[model samples]
Target chain A: MPERSLARYPQAVTDWRDFSDDGLTPTLRAARGLFARNGYHATSIRAVAEAAGLSVPGLYHHHRSKQAILGALVDATMDRMLAHTRAAEADSDGTALGRFDNVLECLLRFHMLRRDDAFVASTEMRSMDDTLLLRHIAQRDEQQRMIADIIAQGVADGTFRCGHVDDGARAAASLCVAVAGWYDPTGVLTADEVVARQLDIARRIAGFPPPP
Target chain B: MPERSLARYPQAVTDWRDFSDDGLTPTLRAARGLFARNGYHATSIRAVAEAAGLSVPGLYHHHRSKQAILGALVDATMDRMLAHTRAAEADSDGTALGRFDNVLECLLRFHMLRRDDAFVASTEMRSMDDTLLLRHIAQRDEQQRMIADIIAQGVADGTFRCGHVDDGARAAASLCVAVAGWYDPTGVLTADEVVARQLDIARRIAGFPPPP
Candidate 1:
């Protein structure tokens, strides 16, 4: 197995501190919680306003409607995910295996660390209007392509012997995205343990050689 | 790879015909659609009754409340999944690899073929009350254990080389369950193709030897 120097990256690239809810506006933060607990269609603007300590009119000043809030949240989540993906790629050792390991670890960590954002962005996609949906889907496709490209490169170089690059990439990404659905902060495994285990499973799926 | 005679099982065991909405009552069928599209928290009893073409009183005769409908839907989906799992196990060649392959294929096919039920059972889980949630969790845990046991047996018998059986099982199951979230009947891949690809991916995740 190839190894990269973790010291080359900034501390935020390897730490969970940057994944907190600090970047979100108060209204978006409150709406994220409400949308996560209650479905978007069931959560009213009044409820979001109350949760965020704003009047309904004041909330409307920031977000035009509930749909707008949902769009903003999903967009923001995807943006952060894309940024982390790029950072992980940049920190890799310029090998397909190294990029695969780093990117998969980054995704699993993001999904588990930002559990609520991931959950809402996944489940509430149906609530977005067609325009927003298309844009979000494009962003998601870019992330999927990142994994597919790595696997393709690996397969070409004989680093990964997987027969099906597209399906293998989909499976790798899908498994990591699922961490948000079942990860428990209070559970037996820490986020690091889960990420490490899943990274191994992903490598195996890609047909990477086991460590000697 | 070990082979099993799928022919030994009844026709329903290997067919998608059994996974249709034929088993649901009219009201439950309507509610399944409503919950899948708008979500459980947003759907009401009146909406379900109207969609089912039943009077409020008539709908009440069958189900006590909206939660009852959701409970019944989730319960029935789990029952079917468990039944299929047992059937797949029975039909296996009595080897760890065989059981893992059959069960993983069965799970992927069910999630894709019965997409709506799987979607509702997964996303609306938070809407179920304490008792219902516990019951549902037990059923889900049973499914998880089925995969874990197979991987553990394989590891012990030298059929699989994967370390961390528990996490491997979770990743295998999680990747299959995620099929329902993204599968499209009208998309490029057919259900058969998707299941075949996902089975290959699951086998790799479990450290099964690649085909020669």
Candidate 2:
């Protein structure tokens, strides 16, 4: 991990001086806001710097380029999401269908919280070089695959009625990508509520049991 | 609507001339290729015109601006998709679930045929103004609402089971958005095969019976 990441560079902007994770929340938050609204292709280092109330050069000191900041944002986000999936799984106790619901719920909540970054990650993978793309896709695919594995286990145990593992994989991936386009944190449904609702939908798609 | 839009426009340097739809199957086809490969924002009118084997002014006589071409292309494609949805509704047998399967099949085939336009439409709508945005979303939401209504109808009839209508609506929208990301027409699956598989998957999500 780059030490100068947004996690480490928040104060670099707000105070017009260098600061790290303990001080960089404002900078990280601002960068996320800009990247979500304008798209990375349309955003520049100067814009993020100004938005956070820092000089362009000030931003440069914390991160080498606009892409570095982007990478840091994405990497940090991916870690948080994957960890959420694990926690959700650990916390839930039920049949395969119940576990499945919990997983989708976890994804929906994470997706809502990181909605803009979710959109950025889904759309901008093309901008990354092969190594970066490979790394990101692996992380992304692993999340889907974990869900797919659960579905596959369900299918094997006769808990769900999927025709193929690939179908489950496809559904899991589609569900995640779908979240980026229309999800709004301010919408009537709380992220917690949404997770439950999406889990219900995911279960139905996976041919699992409806909640009792 | 722009009489002769950018689709038929040749590059500012090319020998192709005029932007009219009259000899246009080849030109529009080329424009789709470029838009798919380079994305709508990065692509220039000159590049589009050149790709079509026409000159810049030749391209311009047809399209007043880059957006005119994009709008016309979207309009043309949306009409086709709407037609496909209607046809799917008409062609399917049995209950609303049957109709939904047809819609899903149509969706898979529609995206396969117009994957480039689908990619463009899903990602480029934010760039359009209110007038175009309204038109696009109206058409898109119309189809989504239709599917949601069918799912809701299925739930009412006990053919499908889900807790909420809004969740069904979200699911339908999410399913469509997912198509833009991972579809590859020339890959292992033929277009029809993909439609068949996706229809099965859609049926499961809607909580309807899979095809016999």
Off by over 4 Å in 1: A1-17, A210-212, B1-17, B210-212
Residue A137 of candidate 1: its Cα lDDT?
90
lDDT of 2 by residue, B87-183 (tens): 6777778587777776776666666555577776776776677888898989887888888888888888888765677667667556755766777
TM-score for candidate 2, please give it: 0.80
Candidate 1 clash total? Answer: 0
> How well docked is model 1, in DockQ terms?
0.44
The candidate scoring highest on TM-score is: 1
> Measured against the native two-chain assembly using Cα atoms, what DockQ does each of the candidate structures obtain, in the order listed?
0.44, 0.31
lDDT by residue (A46-92, candidate 1, tens digit) is: 99999999899888777778988888788778877877888888888
RMSD of 1: 7.6
What is chain B's TM-score across the candidates, in the order shown?
0.88, 0.78
Candidate 2 has an fnat equal to 0.33
Please report, in order, the local distance difference test score of every candidate based on alpha carbons: 0.81, 0.66
Question: After aligning candidate 2 to the native by TM-score, how far in Å is the CA of A36 from where it should be?
Answer: 3.4
